[model samples]
Every structure is written in C-alpha cells, then in structure tokens.
Target: MSTSAQGPTSDESLTPVRWGVLGASNFALTVSLPGMKRGPLTQLAALASRDIGKARDAARSLGIPKAYGSYDELLDDPEIDAVYNPLPNHLHVTWTARAARAGKHVLCEKPIALSAKDAEALVDVQRETGKLIAEAFMIRNHPQWQQARDWVRGGQIGDLVSVQAAFSYFNRDATNIRNKKEVGGGALYDIGCYAVNTSRFLFGREPVRAIALVERDPEFGTDRVTSGLVDYGGAHLTFTCSTQAVAYQRVNALGTRGRLEIEIPFNAPADRPCKVFLDDGSTLNCSSARVTSFPTVDQYHLQSEAFSRAIRTGSPVENSIEVAVDNMRVIDALFRSVESGRWERL
Candidate 1:
C-alpha cells in the first residue's frame, strides 16, 4: 500500500544501500543498473561475472568501483549491503539461498524459483536470515500499476469483471537459455509471468482455478507459447504469452461500469499515461498523476529504493516475498493444468 503522503524523502539524509550485481545480464545493463545509478537510495559498489573480461568490461562501462571474477567473492565483500540476482531461472533458488545464508538482502529477478516448493524455500530462508527479499518484478513498483491498482480498489472501473493481457517477443536464438526447458526457459516463465502478475495485482485477489494450453517444441523441450484462463472469485482473466511471436504487451480491464487500459502498462515509465473509459463512453488519459517527479523515472530504481528502505527502516515492501511465493504457486498450478489437460486448483 503506497501512501501519497509519504512524499519523497530528502536525499542527503537517506541511507544508501551498497549493491553488488551477480550477473551481467542484458536486463541488468539496460534497465536495472541505470535505475540504480539514478536512485539516491543505492550505490553500485561491485559487479561479478564468470568471465573476468566481461566483468571488467561491465565494470568499466558502468563505472562501478569493483569487479569480481566470481559470484562468491562478490557475496563475501564486507562493504556490500545487498545483491541483485540476475542469474538464470534455474539458478534463482540456489543463489538466493546462498545470498540469504551470507546475511545479504536480495532483490532477485522474477520467477524467483522454478517451482512453488523452491519459492517457499526461498521465503523460509528469508525468514530465518531476517533479511529483506524481493523478486525483481519492477513493474509492481512503477506508477502505472500503482495508479491502476488504486482505480481498481477505488471503484473507478466499478466492479472488475474481466481482464485480458498478452506479452511476447521473438526468440529464435537456439543458444539462448529461454529455449531450454531444463534450465527453466519458456514463454510462461519469461514474459507470461508479467501478464499473470499484472492481472493478479489489479484484482488484489487470488485465482481459485486455472486452465491452460501450452505449445512445446521437441527440440527446445520448452513451451514456446502458453495461453490460459484464471478464475478469480467471480472475475475472469484471459492471458497469452509467447517467445516465438513479435513483441507486444498490454493489460486491459473490463468492468461493470467502464473499462481501463494501459499501453505498456507493466514496464512503462513512472510518468506514462494510463487511459480510462466510462460506461457512457467518456475517455480520459493522463500520466501517473501521483508522481510529480521531473523527466522520466525508472521503476527498477524505485523498487530498489523501496527494498533498501525495508532493509534499513524495517518498512514493509509493496511486493513481499510471500506475495511472490503465492504468485509462483499460481503459476505452478497453471503449468500443472497444461500437463493434465484439466482445470487445476490453486
């Protein structure tokens, strides 16, 4: 629950978290690292990559102070406060647990673990270690989602009746991990998780049942596309995700009294516009009215800031580890439904 009254704290006095990057993933380079640079709540202290040359290059390119050739060495740095885990899907659990055991707070990449059981284990480790753990689903911290959530709860769209969403991108590169099932690469775990998370966030309720059809390639051994219907209370959510398709992502809501739609809603800037249509057909579109910040803002930065706040001040995070675990449970059930060709209970 974000409060408008909690206006941006003065930067000079806020505690800055020292962050270490565990991998030089594309997402880390393009989004997360830049966001961290822009944030007053964090400092990029170190970066680690298996390849020393790549690690050195990333460190030089990003202007980070230290580069380690091993992830364990980065973890052992006494000055580091937290880690941003951007490893492969299969590695999320093992590395997150190791970070926890090292007494380091973690903001791991989404789908924190491949299975619900593993997700729960990660949460349990967080509890035992008394460290803040957040999955790097930065969209949850973005203003588009925050405003949309407020509208859904405030009845701006009246009674929420249905949701429709899609997220996809072309991924023909066979060498990419997304094409490997053994490593937890697939459309549902990759982009489809966005649709699922967005739908659940807007509804603020868990689905009771799910049905899905997944298309798999024998060579890749992973589902290239997955479509599903999730029943949340009386509401319905229809979603599709694909790695074989061209890029397209959107989340739309149909309500009893009106409709609400967001273009690039999940990954939009904090100042991005969100549109609403009333039952009478009146339309209004405006930027995230809550944030009066200048220029554009990074959701990753905001998320990291919030997580740091949680660590230092004991403030609760918007997306708790419990929430991530529950979400993974829902996703696990969806996968089960696909396997059984039957409705799966969540």
Candidate 2:
C-alpha cells in the first residue's frame, strides 16, 4: 500500500494509514468509505466482500484499488494498513481480533462487541500488538457534537440540568440484519445506541442509574421501542429509540440559564453546520447545515486520523477501550432495568 497524501505534521516519517473495507455493507458503501475517501491522511487501498462480484463492484464504484473475495485476503495484503469491520454485530470481535493479530489496525462498527468482556479482550489484543482499535461511533468525531460539547462546557448553556433525546427508524424488513435476533439485531443495538451514546457524550459524564420501559415484539424477541432515564451526577436524561417508528433524531438540553435543541443531532455530515439554540430565545443557525449530512463530517476519516495520530503520538484518546467498556456497562444495566421492572443502578 503506497502512502496517500500526508497531512502537515512535524513527523515526516509517519506515513498515511492505508485503509481497507472489510465488508460490502450499506454503511461501508454509503457513509464510512466516503468519509475515508475524503481524508488526506488516509487511503482507500482495498475492499473485501464475501462475494467477489460485489467486492469488484464496490471497488469500481468507490475507486478503490483492490478487491478481494475474502476478508483474510484483504487482511493479508501488505499494502493494507487498516481494515474497517462493518460486518454484523456478532462478527465484530472475531474479525477485529483476526485483523489485529495479522498486524493491521481495526475500526469496527458499534456496539464494539456484544459485551464489555469481549470489548476488554479486544482492547487487550490491541494493547499487546501495539495496534490501534476503535468502534465506529461517528458522532464522537463530528464537528456538530464538538460544538455542542463546547457550548455546554463554555457555559453557553449554563449548569446543564436535563436532557431529552430520541432516535427512531421504521424498518419492517424481516430479512434485514437488524431484525435478526441471532446476530445482535434490535432497536437498542441498531439505533438506541445513538440515544445512549449521545446522552453520555453530550453530558460528558457517567450515568449513575438507568430506568427503562421496553415495548417488545413477541415474535422477534426484540424491543420495538425503549424509553428510559439515565442519571448523570446531578443531571437527568430521558430518551427513546425505536425500529418501528418514523425516523427522527433530536436532542433537547435544559440548563439553569437556558436550553439547547438540535433536530439532526447525530450522523450529520461534517461540512454542514449544526443549528444552535441559545438562551434569550434567539436561534443560531449554521449555513454549514446540509440536508445530505449523515452524522460526523468526514468523521470516519477523523476517527481514522485520530487512531493513527495516537499511534504516532503515543497518547490515549477519549474513545479508548475502557471508555467503550463503560459505554457497554451502561447498556447492560439499561437492559437489565428493562427486564427487572425497576431502576438499575449503573
């Protein structure tokens, strides 16, 4: 893998991270691959799909250099510096470990692993191999989220008090991977994660407890909708996520002085500016806002850049393994709260 255009850095010896796609999933084609393509510090070296024809098609469509029939073949490629694992949720741990063991950096799709234990084990492997590993939570790297964080931290919204957020999408395709219970399919894993991660990210703190009321489908054994409250220090957050509802993503935060609200909170494109609601009943809208946005502005690229930068700079990121594990810990407790009919202390 030849190096792509490098960013302006003091360390000239550090090469651009040559990137490879591990699956031909919709997200890979529609979101992450495009994000990866836009970054200067990364190169789209290859792509792997179970079907050779599909891989070839994706390679042609995306202008990727190489296409492979098997993931291992892509992993084995000397030119490939990193692999993006957009495989099914259950397959995340296996491929991530395999890629790490093969001496390649990994960027796996979220809920990083099925459990905190698996996430920890994967982190252990990355530590041993001295390779980078990250979960594909695009919001973490988006400019809008960065701005939201700044507003809260800078007292644009004084002394944050409460939060209300929701993300929902109606997809009734039983054949879809998200509807398959055997493969980590559910509203929680598919979209509720946005609500969970968003609340955590925006608040910049850990939840003390979680209370949930889940409306489940008997045939699918998956919750159709989940509404819950998460306590963060002195703050309280209320959220809902669903797979059987009209698509929507919204975040409303109330502070002692004022409140902030966003309509397209997560998965927005990078170049687009996110609208800001300030006190004094005035609106701050950004021309950067684009209808075509989908969470994170070149966020995967930023994510990839951050991982490589950490590799080069030898520092820890906020989205470290321990952080991923903590995210899962909250998830676990939330599910338990749903089942136990009471608030689950986190």
Candidate 3:
C-alpha cells in the first residue's frame, strides 16, 4: 500500500509535497498548518473551504499561496501533490476518496471513518488509484512514543504487562463538533482511540476481546465518558476517555519488573521537552525512577514529513489504513459490548 504512490523519478525524489488542506478548521489554523510548514518534505501550498471568505482568510493569515472557494477546485490544481483532510470526522472517507481519485495523495485526520466498514470502502479506491492514503495519527511519529516502544521491546520494563491510560477535557458546548453525534462525536471516537492504538502499539498484538462502560450526554446523545478494558491474550489495557470532565491526560505502562509513566501521554506539548519516567517499584516511590526526555518537536510536522517521504521515496508509512481498520474493529466491539452488557470478541 505504501508503494501505491511509488517513488518519484530520480530528479523528483527530494521534492516536497505541495499540500493543500481541504478546510480551515481551528485545528488546521492553530496546529496543523503551522506544523506542516516545518516538514522536511511538505509545503503549505493551498487551502480550500466551501466558504470563499473563510478560505481566503486562512490563506492570508497562514501565508498559504492559494485559496479556493471549493474543494474540487483545489483538487484540480496541477501543482498540488497531496491533500490533508481535517474536515469533520464524518467526512474523512468521502473527501479522502475524492482526493485520491483526483490524482493526489491524502493524509486524513484520525478516526479515519465512523466505522470499520466505512473505512474498508477506501481500500478499493486506494488500490485502484495507486495513491498513498494515510490517517493522521501524529502521535505515532513522536520520538517519545518510539522511545517508549523501545523500552518495552528492549525489556526496560521487563515484559510488558498492562497499559493504564486516561484522557479527558471538559467541553459541553453544543455547537462544537466533538459534541455532535451525527457527525461522529463522542469520547470513544475522539480520544479513546489513543488508548487502543498505543496499547496495540506496545503489545505488538491484537486484543482477543473488549468490554466497556459508556455514559452518554443526554442533551447531545453522544458518549461523554467511556471506560474500556481490552484483553491482549494474557495482557490487559484499561483506559478511560471523557469529553466532559476535568482537563488531564496520562498513561502508565506496567510490566513484570518495572513500570513506565508517560507524563503528557496524548496532547504532548510541542514547545517543551517530553518526558517519561521509569520506576522499578523497589521503593514504591521516586527513589527508583529514571527520567528520559525528548527535545521539543511538533508531531504533526513529523507526520507530514513521514507521509511525504513515503510518497517521494517509496518508503513505508508509520501507520497505514490497515492499522486504522484494526483499531476501528476494537472500537466497534467496545460499542457493541456496551449494548450487550458483556465482553465482545475482537
């Protein structure tokens, strides 16, 4: 799949992908657009929105060269080589397919689709277009995560046992996309995915089953809080994500001999060094702790660079659509478990 957008000609191998964003969502303006500018093989070339005024405003503020009144117009631009879809969660599949069919590689936002079945629809399109399509799970590109995985694999924690995680924030604004159920709003789809993705990342295996306790917002009809347990053979991962709660996040990975605590597990601050603590559990305190820090970096920039490199050099993607599908399957099972009041096999 990575080779679908085969490496460019010899002379074009080092060329940056002229990235055109589909919308000027707040996340795009405040985070992705700026980070995308720093990529080794990415360019903030254009931005488009259904509203011409919105697109032009975003383009001017971000110094993007072209602004389009419609997504189709930007897709038709000959100089553009890739597209980033930060549209609402519900639109990820439709827009990604459109971008691919228009002869452009695509990097779409997380929760690539509302369901595993919806995500599967892209497989045929990807194969048919021979285009590189990747979900934007920027965390996978962070060096801290890589280092954490290393410690797990290298036995720094001595045989991974379980991963305990929690991510939450108070957001009740009915107007916010994260609160709109029809467009795929909810704690599970928005943040619980990190728990599933990273546990799978560290376990290096799929979970055999899953179960969850979900609490929905009466007004929004969306899961405001969700806690799920996944069984990876003999190992386990317990995580809770919330859309309405005190703002906080952390992840702890425990093993037979030691444990690792990721301080800023999900929303890693880009302006400062990221740290992870290792504890041997000898004293049950800080005395047995070791600290590891990674220099300041924006995960989004790294994500863009990796995808662009894969496009320009025929390299592998850090996380592909197949990975997204597996993740969705776990999430799908969790949702079913809520209804059935029992564990659902993955």
Alpha-carbon RMSD, each predicted model? 4.0, 5.9, 5.3
Instruction: Report lDDT (Cα) of residue 247, candidate 2.
Output: 86
How would you encode candidate 2's per-residue C-alpha lDDT over 1-346 as one tens digit per residue? 1111212222335776788888898878987777778666667899999999999999999999899999999989988888888999999999999998998988788888777778889879988987888777877766556666777888876888888989888987888888888898888888777777877787888989988888887778778898888889789988899989998888887888667676677666556545444443343443222222223245666776676666667655547666777888778888898889898887
For candidate 2, what's the RMSD? 5.9
lDDT of 1: 0.81
The local distance difference test score of model 3 is 0.89
Evaluate model 2: give its TM-score.
0.88
- lDDT by residue for model 1 (247-312), tens: 888877888876667667656654444333223225344233222222355677788888887777
Model 1 lDDT-worst window of ten: 1-10
After the best TM-score superposition of candidate 1, give how far the Cα of residue 178 lies from its true spot, in angstroms: 1.5
TM-score of each: 0.91, 0.88, 0.95
Which of the predicted structures, 1 or 3, would earn the higher lDDT when compared with the native?
Answer: 3
Q: Count backbone overlaps in model 2.
A: 11
Ten-residue stretch with the least lDDT total in model 3: 1-10
| C-alpha lDDT (0 to 100) for residue 104 of candidate 1 | 90
- Candidate 1 — which residues are off by over 4 angstroms? 1-12, 269-295
Which one is best on TM-score?
A: 3
- Ranking under TM-score, best-scoring first? 3, 1, 2
